[model samples]
Target: MANPTRRLEESESEGFVISGKDIGLRMKALEYWKCAELGLQSNPNCAVQSFKVVIAEALPNQGPNQIDTFLSEHGGPGIQHIGLHTSSMSGTIKKLKLHGVEFAEPPATYYSEVGRLHDILGVGQDVQELKELGILIDTEEEGECSKSPRYLLQKFTKPLFDRDTFFLEIIQRIGATGFGSGNITALWRSVQAYMNEKHHPEKS
Candidate 1:
């Protein structure tokens, strides 16, 4: 499914693709991710400035599959996460935090390093603002340009279910349409830390 709709006066769209491949189709599995990147770029945005959500799931108890891991914990193949885009990630995060939504926050060191790249990367928001709001920034290279048009910000909500299967992504795109590939590792670590802190503080 792919269609743009209004989200609180902001343009939004959601695209979904499900494959029933069994384990061992490693190459095929990656196609889903690649397809998602294409989906985000191709989603129409005529009515308003657009945002996108990509939803994916696992087939069954596939080995080492994150989607399957979600299914295992959640009792079925279900929503792994929901990505919501915003123009003002700082303000949006602030409001959500005030409303008691927990998010995975990167450490000060992450922001410190990111700040050093601001000039070269042409980031749109202040490092301090992003750090305070627990937002992560990512930059994509466009053709021969030294830096991309705009950076992306993202934060993941604490899992809504006790089993840690589902969560929300608060996202903002300054100019880029693709997801933040650069932020994946840091975001994963942040999520792992958050999960450990919440589910097993002793392990943290």
Candidate 2:
């Protein structure tokens, strides 16, 4: 989306160039989650390959927000979260909770909606456990309504750092390859809402 108006000559610019302030650059949130994942496999067709690594970045929101405060406290851009993979989200959440790990609570009505419940059960996940554990679920190709549904289950832990800067995401992908927008927005909003309630940071 960035079209540079001019390029700096070899002698005119440093290694980095901060772009000009112009239109069409509006962003709402103060920070966003970025994740990179790698799979290690002995050979192709390996049913389940080991996940070598998953890098997560929490960049400060471009506009005026509390994430800017977090970044300032963090000494610049840094990893604020990590997504851990799990095969059974319900079981994992149950065990983690029993051991005293607190997960972020999604909207209370997240499971109350009938359509959302349908999607969760359609993907062959247990709706009762998901609702009880405050887990978020999302899938694609809703219109097609294939007998087999590809969906993802995700839940976030409360901020691990002293500040509301770092947290962990527990994710389970059932035939889903990419992150779901619904889940991402839900996660971001939940964090923002929590921060606003706890810190009451000034907004520009």
Candidate 3:
């Protein structure tokens, strides 16, 4: 489902607080897809709405792995990757790999730490299964607003097409509404390592 967590009918002002300082953030207008309108009369009393959140961030200097480089190489900025949700990550990964799909393998050091994390919060799936499938796991601690902790597992398909622009992600979230922030950095570094080994850019 193409869901948007936030919607803006008009331009709005927003910023972030970094190191106790307010920093202005850049906002971009992304192209939107048209959907068939629901022909039901809107109810003002019922206060509930659903949407999706598109996360954005600034890229490091003009490196081979930078977003600007990607945009310059590809025609323009588009869907960098698509994340697919699944209930059984291990099964999905096995099936996809059997069909000749290659995935980026996170470093062994990353898994070494997973064992420690598993002790405090239960592992979502079998640790060995995740290792064999090269799946990454992330968890969110329960807070005042949330009653129970959550878990997430994800694996990314290697870049498709010659330009290495678009790719796919297989994800499974348990009691989690937000994407795993920890997974983002871990997976990104792993993907770059994979790219370096396969593509081997002289400078990045």
Question: When superposed on Cα atoms, how far off is each prediction in RMSD?
Answer: 10.6, 10.5, 8.6
Pairwise lDDT winner, candidates 2 and 3: 2
Question: Candidate 2 — which residues are off by over 4 angstroms?
Answer: 1-73, 142-147, 200-204
Q: lDDT per residue, candidate 3, 1-204, as tens digits? A: 111112222233432111101111123333322231443334432212323334454433323433553576578877677778788888899999899999878867666663435622474367677777888887666657767667778899888878877788898877665555455545666767766876766753
lDDT of each: 0.59, 0.61, 0.60
Instruction: Work out the TM-score per prediction.
Output: 0.63, 0.62, 0.66
Collision count of model 2: 2
**How do these models rank on TM-score, best leading?**
3, 1, 2
Better of 1 and 3 by lDDT: 3
Ranking by lDDT: 2, 3, 1
TM-score of 1: 0.63
Clashes per candidate, residues 3 or more apart or on different chains: 0, 2, 6
Candidate 1: segments with Cα more than 4 A from true spot: 1-65, 112-116, 119-121, 143-148
lDDT of 2 by residue, 36-127 (tens): 13344334334343343322333333443334545775787776677788988888999999999977787666676546877877777778
Taking all chains together, the TM-score of candidate 3 against the true structure is: 0.66
**Which stretches of model 3 miss by more than 4 angstroms?**
1-55, 59-66, 114-116, 119-121, 143-147, 201-204
